[model samples]
Target: VRTYKLDTVLLILKCTQESKGCSWYIRAAKIAGSDFFSVTRYRSKHTCSRAVQSSSNCRRRGNPRLVAAVLHEDYPGQFDTPVPKTIVDVVHRRAGVTVSYSTALRGKQLHVSDVRGTPEEGYRMLFSYLYMLEQENPGTKTNVQLDADNRFEYLFVALGASIEGFQ
Candidate 1:
Protein backbone atom coordinates (compact mmCIF):
# COMPACT_ATOMS: atom_id res chain seq x y z
CA VAL A 1 0.00 0.00 0.00
CA ARG A 2 1.06 3.60 -0.56
CA THR A 3 0.55 6.68 1.59
CA TYR A 4 0.30 10.39 0.86
CA LYS A 5 -0.03 13.72 2.63
CA LEU A 6 -3.66 14.53 3.44
CA ASP A 7 -5.49 17.10 1.36
CA THR A 8 -9.01 18.38 0.80
CA VAL A 9 -10.98 20.80 -1.39
CA LEU A 10 -14.41 22.35 -1.57
CA LEU A 11 -17.06 21.08 -3.96
CA ILE A 12 -20.57 22.36 -4.49
CA LEU A 13 -23.34 20.55 -6.32
CA LYS A 14 -26.80 21.62 -7.36
CA CYS A 15 -29.34 19.27 -5.91
CA THR A 16 -32.17 17.49 -7.58
CA GLN A 17 -35.53 17.73 -5.79
CA GLU A 18 -35.61 14.09 -4.88
CA SER A 19 -31.99 13.37 -4.03
CA LYS A 20 -28.74 15.27 -3.66
CA GLY A 21 -25.88 13.99 -5.79
CA CYS A 22 -22.75 12.46 -4.27
CA SER A 23 -19.08 12.95 -5.07
CA TRP A 24 -16.21 10.52 -5.45
CA TYR A 25 -12.70 11.90 -5.23
CA ILE A 26 -9.12 10.65 -5.38
CA ARG A 27 -5.80 12.31 -4.66
CA ALA A 28 -3.08 12.98 -7.27
CA ALA A 29 -0.43 10.86 -5.58
CA LYS A 30 -2.63 7.79 -5.56
CA ILE A 31 -3.71 8.52 -9.10
CA ALA A 32 -0.10 8.42 -10.25
CA GLY A 33 0.72 5.21 -8.41
CA SER A 34 -2.50 3.61 -9.51
CA ASP A 35 -1.72 4.46 -13.11
CA PHE A 36 1.66 2.80 -12.77
CA PHE A 37 0.39 -0.30 -10.93
CA SER A 38 -2.59 -0.65 -13.23
CA VAL A 39 -0.40 -0.78 -16.31
CA THR A 40 1.87 -3.34 -14.69
CA ARG A 41 -1.02 -5.42 -13.40
CA TYR A 42 -2.83 -5.34 -16.70
CA ARG A 43 0.20 -6.61 -18.56
CA SER A 44 0.90 -9.38 -16.10
CA LYS A 45 -2.65 -10.50 -15.46
CA HIS A 46 -3.82 -10.42 -19.07
CA THR A 47 -0.68 -12.18 -20.25
CA CYS A 48 -1.16 -14.87 -17.64
CA SER A 49 -4.79 -15.40 -18.57
CA ARG A 50 -4.04 -15.35 -22.26
CA ALA A 51 -1.50 -18.10 -21.77
CA VAL A 52 -4.35 -20.55 -21.28
CA GLN A 53 -5.63 -19.84 -24.78
CA SER A 54 -4.04 -20.06 -28.21
CA SER A 55 -1.67 -17.07 -27.85
CA SER A 56 -1.22 -16.43 -31.56
CA ASN A 57 -4.93 -16.33 -32.37
CA CYS A 58 -5.77 -14.32 -29.25
CA ARG A 59 -3.11 -11.74 -29.99
CA ARG A 60 -4.48 -11.25 -33.48
CA ARG A 61 -8.14 -11.03 -32.39
CA GLY A 62 -7.99 -8.96 -29.18
CA ASN A 63 -7.13 -5.36 -28.51
CA PRO A 64 -4.83 -6.09 -25.62
CA ARG A 65 -5.16 -2.50 -24.40
CA LEU A 66 -8.61 -3.41 -23.14
CA VAL A 67 -6.76 -4.69 -20.10
CA ALA A 68 -6.09 -1.08 -19.11
CA ALA A 69 -9.77 -0.29 -18.82
CA VAL A 70 -10.08 1.30 -15.39
CA LEU A 71 -13.34 2.39 -13.74
CA HIS A 72 -15.23 0.27 -16.26
CA GLU A 73 -17.48 -1.06 -13.51
CA ASP A 74 -18.21 2.12 -11.54
CA TYR A 75 -18.40 4.83 -14.20
CA PRO A 76 -21.87 4.91 -15.67
CA GLY A 77 -22.23 4.45 -19.40
CA GLN A 78 -18.87 3.01 -20.33
CA PHE A 79 -19.65 2.63 -24.01
CA ASP A 80 -22.31 5.30 -23.62
CA THR A 81 -20.75 7.58 -20.99
CA PRO A 82 -22.45 10.86 -21.69
CA VAL A 83 -20.00 13.51 -22.80
CA PRO A 84 -20.27 16.97 -21.14
CA LYS A 85 -21.41 18.70 -24.34
CA THR A 86 -24.21 16.21 -24.71
CA ILE A 87 -25.44 16.23 -21.11
CA VAL A 88 -25.17 19.73 -19.79
CA ASP A 89 -28.01 19.40 -17.32
CA VAL A 90 -26.77 16.13 -15.91
CA VAL A 91 -23.27 17.46 -15.57
CA HIS A 92 -24.47 20.58 -13.80
CA ARG A 93 -26.68 18.72 -11.41
CA ARG A 94 -24.31 15.84 -10.75
CA ALA A 95 -21.60 18.19 -9.50
CA GLY A 96 -23.06 18.59 -6.03
CA VAL A 97 -21.30 20.55 -3.28
CA THR A 98 -17.82 19.41 -2.25
CA VAL A 99 -15.89 20.83 0.76
CA SER A 100 -12.71 18.83 0.93
CA TYR A 101 -10.40 21.40 -0.64
CA SER A 102 -11.15 24.54 1.35
CA THR A 103 -10.88 22.62 4.58
CA ALA A 104 -7.62 21.03 3.53
CA LEU A 105 -6.18 24.39 2.55
CA ARG A 106 -6.95 25.64 6.05
CA GLY A 107 -4.62 22.92 7.26
CA LYS A 108 -2.05 23.72 4.59
CA GLN A 109 -2.53 20.68 2.40
CA LEU A 110 -3.51 19.82 -1.16
CA HIS A 111 -6.44 18.08 -2.85
CA VAL A 112 -6.93 16.54 -6.25
CA SER A 113 -9.59 15.24 -8.55
CA ASP A 114 -9.66 13.61 -11.98
CA VAL A 115 -12.84 15.32 -13.16
CA ARG A 116 -12.67 16.19 -16.85
CA GLY A 117 -13.65 19.74 -17.82
CA THR A 118 -12.24 23.08 -18.79
CA PRO A 119 -10.31 24.79 -15.98
CA GLU A 120 -12.00 28.11 -16.73
CA GLU A 121 -15.43 26.64 -16.31
CA GLY A 122 -14.34 25.06 -13.06
CA TYR A 123 -12.97 28.37 -11.79
CA ARG A 124 -16.14 30.22 -12.73
CA MET A 125 -18.33 27.58 -11.18
CA LEU A 126 -16.26 27.52 -8.02
CA PHE A 127 -16.33 31.29 -7.72
CA SER A 128 -20.08 31.25 -8.09
CA TYR A 129 -20.28 28.66 -5.38
CA LEU A 130 -18.00 30.67 -3.12
CA TYR A 131 -20.17 33.72 -3.55
CA MET A 132 -23.18 31.68 -2.63
CA LEU A 133 -21.38 30.21 0.34
CA GLU A 134 -20.54 33.67 1.57
CA GLN A 135 -24.12 34.69 1.12
CA GLU A 136 -25.32 31.68 3.05
CA ASN A 137 -22.82 32.18 5.84
CA PRO A 138 -23.74 35.90 6.14
CA GLY A 139 -21.77 37.01 9.19
CA THR A 140 -18.33 35.59 8.65
CA LYS A 141 -15.86 36.88 6.07
CA THR A 142 -15.06 34.28 3.44
CA ASN A 143 -11.41 34.45 2.57
CA VAL A 144 -9.44 31.87 0.60
CA GLN A 145 -5.70 31.49 0.92
CA LEU A 146 -3.63 29.27 -1.34
CA ASP A 147 -1.42 27.13 0.87
CA ALA A 148 0.85 25.84 -1.84
CA ASP A 149 3.19 28.12 -3.80
CA ASN A 150 2.58 26.19 -6.99
CA ARG A 151 -1.17 26.52 -6.60
CA PHE A 152 -0.89 30.25 -5.99
CA GLU A 153 1.30 30.65 -9.06
CA TYR A 154 -1.06 28.52 -11.13
CA LEU A 155 -4.04 30.62 -10.10
CA PHE A 156 -2.17 33.77 -11.08
CA VAL A 157 -1.09 32.33 -14.43
CA ALA A 158 -4.53 31.08 -15.21
CA LEU A 159 -6.16 34.38 -14.31
CA GLY A 160 -3.71 36.24 -16.50
CA ALA A 161 -5.16 34.64 -19.61
CA SER A 162 -8.45 35.71 -21.15
CA ILE A 163 -11.15 33.71 -19.38
CA GLU A 164 -12.30 32.16 -22.63
CA GLY A 165 -8.77 30.97 -23.30
CA PHE A 166 -9.25 28.27 -20.66
CA GLN A 167 -12.22 26.89 -22.50
Candidate 2:
Protein backbone atom coordinates (compact mmCIF):
# COMPACT_ATOMS: atom_id res chain seq x y z
CA VAL A 1 0.00 0.00 0.00
CA ARG A 2 1.62 3.16 -1.22
CA THR A 3 0.05 5.45 1.37
CA TYR A 4 2.65 7.82 0.02
CA LYS A 5 4.15 7.14 -3.40
CA LEU A 6 7.87 6.52 -3.38
CA ASP A 7 9.61 9.06 -5.58
CA THR A 8 13.22 9.84 -6.42
CA VAL A 9 13.37 12.26 -3.56
CA LEU A 10 11.15 10.78 -0.88
CA LEU A 11 9.81 7.42 0.29
CA ILE A 12 7.28 7.05 3.04
CA LEU A 13 5.51 4.03 4.41
CA LYS A 14 2.78 3.97 7.01
CA CYS A 15 1.73 1.21 9.31
CA THR A 16 -1.18 -1.06 8.32
CA GLN A 17 -3.01 0.41 11.32
CA GLU A 18 -2.62 4.00 10.11
CA SER A 19 -6.40 4.40 9.91
CA LYS A 20 -6.64 3.21 13.50
CA GLY A 21 -4.05 5.85 14.50
CA CYS A 22 -1.05 3.56 15.02
CA SER A 23 1.80 6.03 14.74
CA TRP A 24 4.34 3.72 13.10
CA TYR A 25 5.79 5.21 9.95
CA ILE A 26 9.09 5.81 8.17
CA ARG A 27 10.16 8.57 5.86
CA ALA A 28 13.44 8.47 3.94
CA ALA A 29 14.91 11.10 1.67
CA LYS A 30 17.57 10.81 -0.98
CA ILE A 31 20.75 12.73 -0.27
CA ALA A 32 21.36 15.35 -2.89
CA GLY A 33 23.90 14.42 -5.65
CA SER A 34 24.49 10.99 -4.12
CA ASP A 35 22.60 7.70 -4.40
CA PHE A 36 22.04 7.32 -0.68
CA PHE A 37 18.68 7.43 1.03
CA SER A 38 18.76 8.39 4.69
CA VAL A 39 15.92 7.94 7.14
CA THR A 40 14.82 11.52 7.69
CA ARG A 41 12.08 10.80 10.22
CA TYR A 42 10.60 7.61 11.60
CA ARG A 43 8.27 6.41 14.29
CA SER A 44 9.52 2.84 14.58
CA LYS A 45 7.10 1.86 17.33
CA HIS A 46 3.86 0.28 16.15
CA THR A 47 1.30 1.49 18.64
CA CYS A 48 -1.33 -0.88 17.29
CA SER A 49 -0.89 -4.58 17.74
CA ARG A 50 -0.97 -6.62 14.57
CA ALA A 51 -3.72 -9.16 14.26
CA VAL A 52 -2.55 -12.75 14.74
CA GLN A 53 -1.66 -14.31 11.44
CA SER A 54 -4.10 -17.10 10.64
CA SER A 55 -3.63 -19.95 8.16
CA SER A 56 -5.82 -18.13 5.67
CA ASN A 57 -4.02 -14.82 6.23
CA CYS A 58 -0.51 -16.00 5.48
CA ARG A 59 0.72 -12.91 3.66
CA ARG A 60 3.53 -12.71 6.17
CA ARG A 61 4.97 -16.01 4.97
CA GLY A 62 8.45 -15.16 3.69
CA ASN A 63 9.04 -15.37 -0.04
CA PRO A 64 11.59 -18.05 -0.87
CA ARG A 65 13.37 -15.96 -3.51
CA LEU A 66 13.58 -12.91 -1.24
CA VAL A 67 14.89 -15.07 1.57
CA ALA A 68 17.42 -16.64 -0.80
CA ALA A 69 18.67 -13.27 -2.01
CA VAL A 70 19.20 -12.04 1.55
CA LEU A 71 20.95 -15.27 2.45
CA HIS A 72 23.27 -14.84 -0.52
CA GLU A 73 24.25 -11.39 0.74
CA ASP A 74 24.82 -12.67 4.28
CA TYR A 75 26.84 -15.73 3.21
CA PRO A 76 28.13 -14.79 -0.21
CA GLY A 77 31.01 -17.29 -0.56
CA GLN A 78 29.48 -20.01 1.61
CA PHE A 79 25.86 -20.86 0.91
CA ASP A 80 26.04 -24.03 3.01
CA THR A 81 27.24 -22.24 6.15
CA PRO A 82 23.86 -21.68 7.85
CA VAL A 83 21.91 -24.65 9.19
CA PRO A 84 18.22 -24.84 10.05
CA LYS A 85 18.31 -22.96 13.32
CA THR A 86 20.84 -20.44 12.06
CA ILE A 87 18.76 -19.85 8.95
CA VAL A 88 15.63 -19.14 10.96
CA ASP A 89 17.45 -16.79 13.32
CA VAL A 90 19.41 -14.96 10.61
CA VAL A 91 16.36 -14.20 8.47
CA HIS A 92 14.47 -12.89 11.47
CA ARG A 93 17.32 -10.69 12.60
CA ARG A 94 18.35 -9.33 9.23
CA ALA A 95 15.09 -9.26 7.27
CA GLY A 96 12.75 -8.67 10.22
CA VAL A 97 10.66 -11.51 8.85
CA THR A 98 9.84 -14.69 10.72
CA VAL A 99 10.06 -17.86 8.67
CA SER A 100 9.54 -21.52 9.48
CA TYR A 101 12.16 -24.25 9.12
CA SER A 102 10.54 -25.41 5.90
CA THR A 103 10.61 -21.88 4.42
CA ALA A 104 14.27 -21.50 5.29
CA LEU A 105 15.07 -24.86 3.73
CA ARG A 106 13.10 -23.94 0.63
CA GLY A 107 14.93 -20.60 0.36
CA LYS A 108 18.31 -22.30 0.58
CA GLN A 109 17.21 -24.85 -1.95
CA LEU A 110 16.00 -22.09 -4.27
CA HIS A 111 19.29 -20.19 -3.97
CA VAL A 112 21.38 -23.27 -4.66
CA SER A 113 19.17 -24.29 -7.56
CA ASP A 114 19.47 -20.81 -9.04
CA VAL A 115 23.26 -20.90 -8.81
CA ARG A 116 23.82 -24.54 -9.81
CA GLY A 117 20.92 -26.01 -11.66
CA THR A 118 19.73 -29.58 -11.15
CA PRO A 119 22.05 -32.25 -12.51
CA GLU A 120 19.36 -33.43 -14.91
CA GLU A 121 18.90 -29.95 -16.36
CA GLY A 122 22.66 -29.42 -16.57
CA TYR A 123 23.06 -32.64 -18.52
CA ARG A 124 20.17 -31.70 -20.80
CA MET A 125 21.86 -28.40 -21.67
CA LEU A 126 25.37 -29.86 -21.83
CA PHE A 127 25.42 -30.53 -25.58
CA SER A 128 24.18 -27.06 -26.47
CA TYR A 129 26.66 -25.42 -24.16
CA LEU A 130 29.49 -27.41 -25.71
CA TYR A 131 28.26 -26.51 -29.19
CA MET A 132 28.51 -22.80 -28.31
CA LEU A 133 31.89 -23.43 -26.73
CA GLU A 134 33.13 -25.01 -29.96
CA GLN A 135 31.71 -22.18 -32.06
CA GLU A 136 33.45 -19.54 -29.94
CA ASN A 137 36.87 -21.21 -29.77
CA PRO A 138 36.98 -22.50 -33.38
CA GLY A 139 39.18 -25.54 -32.54
CA THR A 140 37.59 -26.75 -29.31
CA LYS A 141 37.03 -30.48 -28.99
CA THR A 142 34.45 -32.17 -26.78
CA ASN A 143 33.63 -35.81 -26.21
CA VAL A 144 30.56 -36.92 -24.21
CA GLN A 145 30.01 -40.61 -23.59
CA LEU A 146 26.51 -41.98 -22.95
CA ASP A 147 25.63 -45.26 -21.31
CA ALA A 148 23.27 -47.93 -22.67
CA ASP A 149 20.26 -46.02 -21.32
CA ASN A 150 21.63 -42.80 -22.85
CA ARG A 151 22.59 -41.41 -19.46
CA PHE A 152 25.65 -39.24 -19.17
CA GLU A 153 28.75 -41.31 -18.45
CA TYR A 154 31.79 -39.22 -19.35
CA LEU A 155 32.83 -35.77 -20.54
CA PHE A 156 36.11 -34.57 -22.11
CA VAL A 157 36.84 -31.07 -23.33
CA ALA A 158 40.01 -29.72 -24.99
CA LEU A 159 39.99 -26.12 -26.10
CA GLY A 160 41.50 -25.20 -29.50
CA ALA A 161 43.63 -22.46 -27.92
CA SER A 162 45.17 -25.00 -25.56
CA ILE A 163 45.97 -27.33 -28.47
CA GLU A 164 47.71 -24.60 -30.49
CA GLY A 165 49.67 -23.26 -27.52
CA PHE A 166 50.95 -26.74 -26.65
CA GLN A 167 52.62 -27.04 -30.10
Q: What C-alpha RMSD separates each model from the true structure?
A: 21.3, 8.3
Candidate 1 RMSD computed on C-alpha atoms after optimal superposition onto the true structure: 21.3
Runs with alpha carbons beyond 4 Å of true place in candidate 1: 1-72, 75-116, 143-167
Q: Residue 136 of model 2: what lDDT? A: 95
Could you tell me every candidate's TM-score relative to the true structure? 0.23, 0.49
Query: What digit string (tens of lDDT, one per residue) describes model 1 on residues 79-156?
Result: 334332323233223432122322322212111122344577786586576667556654423445566662533222
Off by over 4 Å in 2: 1-66, 72-90, 99-106
Each prediction's whole-model lDDT (CA) = 0.31, 0.79
lDDT, candidate 2, at 149:
100
